[model samples]
Target: MAKAFASAGDMTEKTISFTEVGEGLYAFTAEGDPNSGVIIGDDSVMIVEAQATPRLANKVIDCVRSVTDKPISHVVLTHYHAVRVLGASAFGADQIIMSDKARSMVAERGQEDWDSEFDRFPRLFEGHESIPGLTWPTTTFSGRMSVFLGQRRVDLMQLGRAHTAGDIVIHVPDQNVMFTGDIVEYHSACYCGDGHFGDWGKTLDAIKAYDLDAIAPGRGDALIGREMVNAAIENTRDFVASTYAPAAKVAARGGTLKEAWDAVRAACDPKFADYAIYEHCLPFNVARAFDEAQGIDTPRIWTAERDKAMWAALQG
Candidate 1:
């Protein structure tokens, strides 16, 4: 098993690992920590997600340098999460791309999320000082955007809402490879604090509509074959279901947020107990589910004070 509790200070100097998922595609994973994907074409390269800081992104750049010297023309953000977007400046890509909704989220709450995430997982931030501030996309798209680097076609599609309102998937048709953002995680925990449970399920269904041979998820190891890809998606779907079903059931029966939280904890703890960051994610996931169960659409702001208060009240 991967070590679960690396000291925060240890994060500052940590390097990332590169796993080749396809011919020229790579998944940059750090144990069970958040991951970034890289897709290299005939002429240029497209980075799927930026890491948390410039210092960390340099590690991924080094891996890409080792294999190819193609310029990183585009940095595609899968969503507006702090860890995924803040490190974009380090790439110096000609264009930073994201969905319109994701850009708006950044405008609204990027700083708050930056602060919250750093507080929550200092280990992942590693070289937080290297960040140049909130990373904003230079190019924004609405539904879908398709690009061709020589003959390789890359399709950036907003399948539906999952991990966040603006989640997207990068599909390489010929390679049959897809880079799912936080919409799909493997082995590691899913942070549902800004997720849409019902919409998230629909997004998974849309993902299954693709002809994928492999998948590089937002966390954990990259799925190598069709079977493994499907299993990862199924596991993520089940994880989402298990998280909300109990909370919804209790809410329907007039349970308090505290009661619903307890129910969700009991329901998911057994199944997802061993996943990385489960302890860190459970409280937030339960809180989000509890609110969604009560018909709340948008997730409430998660400031540092709110995080502490919720943890104190929900945790035993």
Candidate 2:
């Protein structure tokens, strides 16, 4: 990801940077906004994640223009989050690739997620009006899919589920680099609202098995060097563990959601106090964790009204 910047609103608080993660592979990361990755192959460019809207997507396009003149032919979405996939039409890519699970998620909950996420984070969806509708992937895969940019092979693998049911990671074996979609967040708040906490840890372990030298995370800067990668992984795991462990403990004690939220806050608030969106994500994270601890496999769909109701019940 070649580095660049664009001033969003003050709520965003920073410009986006297009950092070069590997040769022809870039990560467009905002301060804490949805991160997009770029893979410029031999003949064309493949954007990993589209922004919430075209206005935001164009910023990434502008950065890509600085590096190569190749047209973007594909938009690969790791999951079906509105903040990450809704801007696909703006790229005008001929093909949009996604995992089968991701496609199913869109079919089942895409509309609700679109409405839910828009209400959750308005800044990321700058040009909501420009969106045609729910982003549907033209090319879908089940377990793993390999894309070749001329001779460069980019392996898109559905590692275990963490952030969402359909999470995928783009791996460039030749470059020894991997682009993890929200699987590994650096410094920013972890959105465990719809995550599988137990499976998420396993996914991290699966990612660690790879001898990756560099990684482009879903949020924050591109991580370079082996030690920093280890630290990021550890930090992410710790954050998830702290979140789920406390919530599970409270639930096991027959505590109510309110009590569970408070217990999690007492355990995690001090440790993750400085993380971005701590206040915003805590209530939701606890809710999901509580459900997971109680043997729920799938996350409940989050609607805008449900969001406010949950916040009012838990935080108020």
Candidate 3:
């Protein structure tokens, strides 16, 4: 039998965990589902990455309520992916922050992404109907922006393009904890549907420059020490390299996309087959890698129709 398209068949619910990685830093992780970070400052809280829907985000709110009574004052979007930002309404944050490029991407492809992601991962959008629509950034910065929550300092920086053209990371310098968006996925497949493979590697290198003690990655378990943080970064780098290297090699030889896909699967499956979303991301990852190998610098915007066609072609 043919495999299900994307994650359409994945209905199994995952156990959620709220781990305190630093003094007041928390990682809200749902098995391998998209993860969100919480930074509790002196007077308020800042959330990194909203859940897929307002109803879904309520659960995260409950988690926050269980720990503190301080209102959530800010929502920081790491990128423009629908699964990560559509739940901003539930936060009731005073400011929804994002990079300027991220805001632009939302204006350009937010609707298409909403439709495409909803079809791809039904389980993540459990309360899809409650989504108030595209989440917009109330505040946008071109490079780096710093927020001082009393004495705590949280810096939002757009290092370079990676998972998306406008990927950003939240750095807590005092606590040495970094909330890296999908730019770094620990023990999870990096979805490259709208990624720049070459630039992503350089971005990873830039992330290493920080002296980090812990990391709240986009997925998987939270990294709690410098050793684990470095390991997660290395693992992410390896996964990206393993996925793209084979496909790029094939494309460099003027091979067909199927050939490139097959090569990548053969190269990556042994190691990453058990990772979350590995199957869901393979087709898109290989497609992007093939394009990059052929000297395509920009990632193509993915629509619902294109998603189905790409999945069908790869599955065939």
Candidate 4:
């Protein structure tokens, strides 16, 4: 391999910050690592996304302990990604909720995604052995589901597809705050390996229509205010558009995947080189964009073996 996959060399632990984005709503962000949202309801608590492993989940639990002693009664997974769902078992929440499409994705390619992600970024899976098996949602719904943690109403919605086919967002009506899983990221590269590029902007428009007060994005810092939230949403929009345009152009010209890679790098690197996971997500993003431009709707499953093959092909 010309160089190790980006995550292979990123063994340095990140400093975790627990920032309160809204009243009793918090965002547990670790530098550029995946973020988890905490919604402290009237009686119990609702966790937005589970970390990659039980050990990482425990860290989020500790952050929850600092703020409220409310037991976690619900865990809402925004999508079926391993980093977001595998740690669900550790939460022991009575209700493990996911969108119906998300649960189906879990059945379709859950194990493969777990294997692929683990191999790509082992650092995220600190206690891999502790993961009993693939995480399954106890409850699944389509379109929208309103989950109440006592009197507090947390509306779970499926605006459209962006990060993944099953992507969803957790919205709190009282505070007008939404916990957008990987659908929205701040200062971090959007992982589009399983994404729908054509629908990503539509999804962003859905979230933007809300004009919420705060949003705890999937990664990067918590979006604290209107200006910051809008900026992050648009930034993510720019990232996705910037990544696909050049790759699409290459595909239009019947260029090789390597050529698409070069085009994407030339287009995205100058603007997003300093963003978190920019290099790591580049190849996958480019590959998917190239395929989408050629009319491939569904993203192909990424197994551990395929990850290696893709990385090897993009070594240029």
Give the candidate number with the greatest lDDT: 4
Off by over 4 Å in 2: 1-10
Candidate that beats the other on lDDT, 2 or 4, i.e. the better one = 4
Report the poorest 10 consecutive residues by lDDT, candidate 3.
1-10
Cα lDDT tens digits, model 3, 1-316, are: 3466758998998899999999999999997899999999999999999989897788899999989999899999999999999999999999999999999999999999999898888888987878877899999998899998889999999999999999999999988889999998888999987899888889988888886889999999999888998988998999999988999889988998889989998999999999998889999999999998998887888888898787777767
Candidate models: Cα lDDT each:
0.85, 0.87, 0.91, 0.93
Which of the two, 1 or 3, has more lDDT?
Answer: 3
Q: Candidate 4: misplaced stretches above 4 Å?
A: none
Task: List the candidate numbers ranked by TM-score, top first.
Answer: 4, 3, 2, 1
Q: Which digits, one per residue and each the tens of the lDDT, describe model 1 over residues 33-122?
A: 778999999999999889888877887899899989999998999999888888888889999999999999998888888887887778
CA lDDT, candidate 4, residue 65: 98
Query: Lowest-lDDT window of 10 residues in candidate 2?
Result: 1-10
What is candidate 2's TM-score against the reference? Answer: 0.95
What global local distance difference test value does model 1 have? 0.85
Residue-wise lDDT of candidate 2 within 107-204, one digit each (tens)?
A: 99999989888777767776689999999999999889899888889899998999998999999888989999899988877888889999999999
* TM, every model: 0.94, 0.95, 0.98, 0.99
Tens-digit lDDT track of model 4 for 260-287: 9999899898999999988899989998
lDDT of 4 at 153: 90
lDDT measured at residue 155 in model 4 versus the true structure, 0 to 100:
97
